[model samples]
Target: MSTTPPRLTTASGIPVADHQNSLSAGRRGPLLLQDFHLIEKLQHFNRERIPERVVHAKGSGAYGSFTVTHDITRYTSAKLFAQVGQATETFVRFSTVGGERGSADTERDPRGFALRFYTEDGNWDLVGNNTPMFFIKDPIKFPDFVHTQKRDPQTNLKSAQMMWDFWSHAPESLHQVTMLFSDRGTPDGYRHMDGFGSHTYSLINAAGERVWVKWHLKTQQGIKNLMADEAARLAGTDPDHAQRDLFEAIARGDFPRWNVYIQVMTEAQADTWEQRTGWNPFDLTKVWPHADCPRIPVGVVTLNRNPDNYHAEVEQAAFSPANLVPGMGYSPDKMLQGRLFAYHDAQLYRVGTNHQHLPVNRARCPFHHQQRDGAMAIANGGAAPNYETVNAAGTAPSGFGHGDPGWALHGVAGRYDERGESDDFTQAGNLFRLMPPDAQDRLTTNIAHAMQHVSDDVQQLQIGHFTKADPAYGAAVRRKLADLREG
Candidate 1:
């Protein structure tokens, strides 16, 4: 029997005989830069890390499939929802929004629930959170809000003062702040909580009719949370508790799953929803009540496979709301629009110019584009034609639609003040009232304890916003704090 000799080659395809020894002036002399192999290896290692995410720095992911359980093909022409039993490959990542890679898994913070669907059309990424609503609606306030959640520059520590200061100034945060302080903020693990597509998106049917929509993923394991005290204890005992829970549970053949559902609104209804609710339909800080827009079950997503390499499959796995399929489109939600640009730009910086070429982020379907070559080019597009004729038909289906519907815009381009124009308090106030009595009590007590270290000036200012949301809300929180001071 004959076998081919083992081959060794450099990145440029040059055959190499010795990779261990580098060329030097002598056996004991200084090495030479002309040693292309050594220089290349060292240079690549020097640039190994791009940059950790400004948010969602720590995360875990799993391989899964989405099986459509119910179909509403009339609502969306998206291939993923085209049939009642269609199954699509998926990847879901759960993360702590403000924590570093080594932060405690039990941190009382909103969790990131990012889903990537490898549909026949392309990858449709529904990058969302475990909560249905967010802290702020406007994209401009995001950087400032996150800054307060992160460590203080001077002290290099997480500062309650910074967090409270920002919340007091931004009244829109009351709803999310209330949610964060409650039991739900400290989720038991990644498997026991629901997820939300927080931003409103558009669905275009085959006929080109557009409707606003939101997605939800209800966990099959049922909702479970750690109380404030339990969370604190777990934080000290096991920082990787959630990560281990997900991996171990999957390894035991007990796959975690979620029931996918969507709430949709017709264009005509969207026109009047703002007036009806006193909140913008596209606002990220609010949610369309299920009573008004009942959830229509669409599918079930089951995570059956755990990642073999966390760094390659999870750390470098990029998901973006901008990754929309043909029949799906974007709404005018400012935060979602800002993210469409930010997420891809962030991936390019954090991973590489050709980050999409990675096996995890790459498209499943044969995708053709003019993009090619960068720091890690896959052979620089080989000998393919770099230029094509001016026309290759339209980018959309035959006579269906080309892009997102062109809605009319008439506002003057200026920094328009939204204080009087927008109703930020009503929704948050209603959320407080809707909570059960016991939950409301826990929420206030949690706030009081967390604010014990906060300054009076900031505390007073913050409570004032809660007061506007509900007098009872403000009074309960104030009473708790007063007792703490007296004791």
Candidate 2:
């Protein structure tokens, strides 16, 4: 048996004699133009990095398995949840939203919890966030909201004034704004925070009965958060603290897990609940209280394997809400409807036209499609017909069944404002009141600290929204702002 390592070769399989040096006139003269190896190396290196995600740029991903723990077939006939012990291969990406690729992990920002389950049917991506609610209910305001979270145009720095100014104008942002300032905003790490499919989705049963659902991944590690001071210190000292923690934990066999739960609501129940509470079930800014729609245990997701190549497995990985299998479907959530198009389009631009052909994003199950001939087309349908056709017998081939259970749409096709139509302040107030006195104090203090750089008008306007939520909540924030400013 040969016990020698193989000789290095160029990309074209040509043996390489000198890899450390380029072909030069002498020792350090001008390089020869015939040095294809040198040119290949430099060119590949220059184009190695793809465009970073517009949001959720800094992320860590891992492979794992999702084991069904309880029966939910009555709600959805998704093959992944067919039995109590079924285990489906999974990959999860934890990210910091609104941060650049090199941003600190401990920044006070909403975390992205995007999960992909490779089931027998296909890959199902549950693209979500650590928080159950978002800052805006409508997708039209999303770009505007995200712009505020990013660098200011003139100064090229994050501006609290811009954030507060936007929030003050959009009362729908109150609930998420409140959550962002709370300790939950700066979670200890990815393992200690909960993940929620913030948009209301739908689950269709074998009987074709559809139900509105909200997905939740409750961390088994329990919720642990960092105070603002500690978070800031860690951000400066160890910018990759969370990424290191996750990688090290999995390496040492201390795998992290989250118990999956889903809150179900029937169509009739959704209508009645919306009328009773004066809240739209499809509103991205609100949450369906557990009291009204109880959570049902479904499965357990454990991240036991870290990616071998960060760029190949993690960076190129793309998850879209549009990736749905049978028994799962979409809803009327405006934000979700917008994402259905935006997510895939972004990946098409960022990861290339055939991003799905990448190993990390590929479905485990066998799939056949007429789509072919794109850049980096790994399979390219392998000589299969690229278009559907009817045979000489005048019969079409069997195709994938429709997964989405259609719903009725009854509304004027025009821009309808939802400002005074929804009760955004009540939920924000309810969340504030739910916290203990100490937690409430910390929340108020955090809000005050974040608002320090904002203008007085924005602060007062935001305080008024808080007042509408709860008098004490508003009063506490106002008092803390005064004390912090005075000090």
Off by over 4 Å in 1: 1-45, 391-404
- Report backbone clashes per prediction: 0, 0
Candidate 2: pairs in clash: none
**TM-scores for the candidates:** 0.91, 0.96
For each candidate, what is the lDDT?
A: 0.88, 0.92
lDDT of 2 by residue, 301-389 (tens): 99999999999999999999999988999999999999999999999999998899899999998988877887988869876779988
**Highest-scoring model, TM-score:** 2
lDDT of 1 by residue, 266-360 (tens): 88898888887788888888889889999999999999999999988999999889999988888889889889998998998889888888888
Compute the lDDT for candidate 2: 0.92
Error at 210, model 1, angstroms: 1.0
